[model samples]
Target: MPDLVIALDVGGSSVKSGVVQADHTVYQRRTTPIDSSGPAESILATLAAIIDGHARTLGKDAVLRGVGLGFPGPFDYAQGVCYIHGVAKYEALYGLHMDAELRARLAWGPKPPIRFRNDAEAAIIGEFCYGAGRSFVRGIGVTLGTGFGSTFVVEGKPQRAGPGVPPNGWLYAESWQGQQADDVFSARGLQARLAAAFGRPLDIPTAAQRARVGDQQLQEVFRRFGADLGAFLYPYARAFDAHVVLILGGIAHAMDLFETAVAQALRLPVRGGALGPDAALLGAAELFFA
Candidate 1:
């Protein structure tokens, strides 16, 4: 029988889950809201139901070893306890026994082997085995979403860092987001810039178009965005000595226009993420497969 594992990446807005073979090739994937208002028990129950729905399709004979989970916030990998939970502005999980209920509802067997990992760290594991971080001993991934986030791989495994810094990786410094990075570079930052500069909301393609056509203001805006990220990311690059740094997200995807400014500002070399949206899904697989 082909061995199978169910994995879920719990994020602030949504939960990304999938089933993968032992080799970590994803066979199925799904996403849903991270509903937390209905008590942690309800959350776990829904999660189990979600997993079971996928499990039935994998077949009963498929040797479904267990489900691996990635939760945002601080976690005690050894103790399986939720510590300082703050992924999406939710406070219900602060002292919750996230693992216990996850096991009870999500892992349903006498010998169930549910494994949990830090969200960002798990991303690194997935990237290493099934995504872009494969060859580099030092792999770093930044999730540039509502916030700038990151994770690292050292010696072919997740290297943990942080109890703070708003979840952005590579550069956790307040300067990266709350202060400068996002304040001047992210999607929201760009929106504000356009509203201020053009007196309206403008998309990237349009902004890039204008910039390419020699629109000085638009060009400078994107340039400043890159420069800020570069400056914020340089210290971490130097500290971790990572050869490949991946920038993942809508903002990071458009690296061509802003990358130079960011690189020049930080005086470091960072590249676009190799995996795209698959990083989180693959990271879910790493929970059990790794």
Candidate 2:
């Protein structure tokens, strides 16, 4: 029987879970809401259910080895404590011993090691080992979603954030055009830019649709965003000696509008993620194996 792990990729909007084998093959997968607005315990319960539901599918022969999870941070990844506060997302989870509580709720027959990593970190590892980054020995990954998430990896190990890379491998805090990168690189940021340009608000999906139809304003927004992304990553990539970049997250679906600009500005190969959206889930499982 193959060794298996229950893995989760927790995002601001949803939780993606799966039973995965050591070779990065998923046996079963599921997704549920994160319910960030709910009580902290409720959010933990949702994660527990997702893990339990998937583990049950393994049956008696399954050699369950561990549980792995990847989620947003500004939190203590080592301590499993949530520190993301006053941001209207996961704020209810502050000061909670998130890892211990999650372990207590999960009903595995024999408890396994539970490990956590910043969601973007896990996603990049997944890409490095199994996706568009597999061909590269050194690379960077950027996930365009609620925030501008990024990671730098070399020889299959994640590089820590330093002089050029901001904290936790994130590039959102860097200064650009006299403004913080977060002010121009996220979902809300894009919408705000669109509102300022078009005199109306447009949601991310709608804005992406508009960009696809030759809406010059929207197209320019993404183009600029892509260019900003390239500018933000240039120094970090050079510092890390990254050879390729893998773009992930829901925003990657609209790469057609911005990829060229990103590639042109970065002067490196930029490609959409190849693992679909499950890269984080697989990477979470890899944490145990690592």
- Best-fitting candidate, scored by lDDT: 2
TM-score of 2: 0.92
lDDT (tens digit, per residue) of candidate 1 on 1-290: 77887888777667788887877677677888867555666677777777777776765577987777776656665566776554444356566666676666744454356777767666666776666667677756676655555676665566656432234343434564456554554567776776688778898768878887889998888787677666666766767776766666667656777877866765655666566556666776666665
Q: Provide the lDDT at 86 for model 2.
A: 80
lDDT of each: 0.67, 0.81
lDDT of candidate model 1 versus the reference: 0.67
Please write out the lDDT profile of model 2 over residues 1-290, one tens digit for every residue: 88888888887778888888888788677778778878898898988888778877777988888888897787788888888888877888888877788878988666567788889888888888888898899888887777777787877777776555556667778788887777777777777887888898878788889878889988998898788778877887877777998898777887888898888888999988888767888788888766
Once superposed on the true structure, which residue ranges of model 2 sit more than 4 Å away at CA?
161-164
* TM-score per model over all chains: 0.79, 0.92
lDDT of 2: 0.81
